[model samples]
Target: MGQKKRFLLRLDEKLYETVEKWSADELRSVNAQIEYLLTEAVKKAGRWKQEQGQSEKE
Candidate 1:
């Protein structure tokens, strides 16, 4: 693991509410849910590099 970059993200109200609900259902914070979604998209696009000793499932 490494230090995570931080930035402000502005989302549409409806979209935020949707993500909030989804995050609760998944037992993850909104931030975690967003990161997870982004990671999955990247992997699906073959744009994510797997770190040493890290499985794709991670």
Candidate 2:
């Protein structure tokens, strides 16, 4: 875990509703689900680097 940056995100109603449902299904808060999805997307695209000595324990 690392320091989290906070900011505002403006999303369309339909998208927000969909994400809210998905988050509930995954047993995570909407914010957590969004972070999880973004992290996965970055990893999938090979655009994020693993911290030194960090393990892929996810």
Candidate 3:
């Protein structure tokens, strides 16, 4: 693993609640859940660098 960058994120109350529930169901923290979703989206869009593994983006 690499050092993670941190920043502030603000979400609508309803959206946050939905993500909270989904995160629980998936047994991941809210932050991890969001990261997972974004990673999948990037892969689907052909933006993830498969040769470099999941942590790299292109």
Off by over 4 Å in 1: none
TM-score of 1: 0.89
- What do the candidate models score in CA lDDT, each in turn? 0.95, 0.93, 0.87
| Residue-level lDDT tens digits of model 3 in 1-58 | 5689899999999999999999999999999999899989988999976655554543
Model 2 / residue 26 / CA error / Å: 0.8
lDDT of 2 by residue, 6-57 (tens): 9999999999999999999999999999999999999999998888998977
Error of 1 at 57 (Å): 3.1
lDDT string for model 1 (1-58, tens) is 6999999999999999999999999999999999999988998999999899998776
- For model 2, the run of ten residues with the poorest summed lDDT: 49-58
* Total backbone clashes of candidate 2, pairs 3 or more residues apart or in separate chains: 0
Candidate 3 Cα outliers beyond 4 Å, as residue runs: 51-58
Model 1 gets an lDDT of: 0.95
What TM-score would you give candidate 3 relative to the actual structure? 0.80
In model 3, the worst 10-residue window by lDDT is: 49-58
Better of 1 and 2 by TM-score: 2
Please tell me which predicted candidate would have the highest TM-score against the true structure. Answer: 2
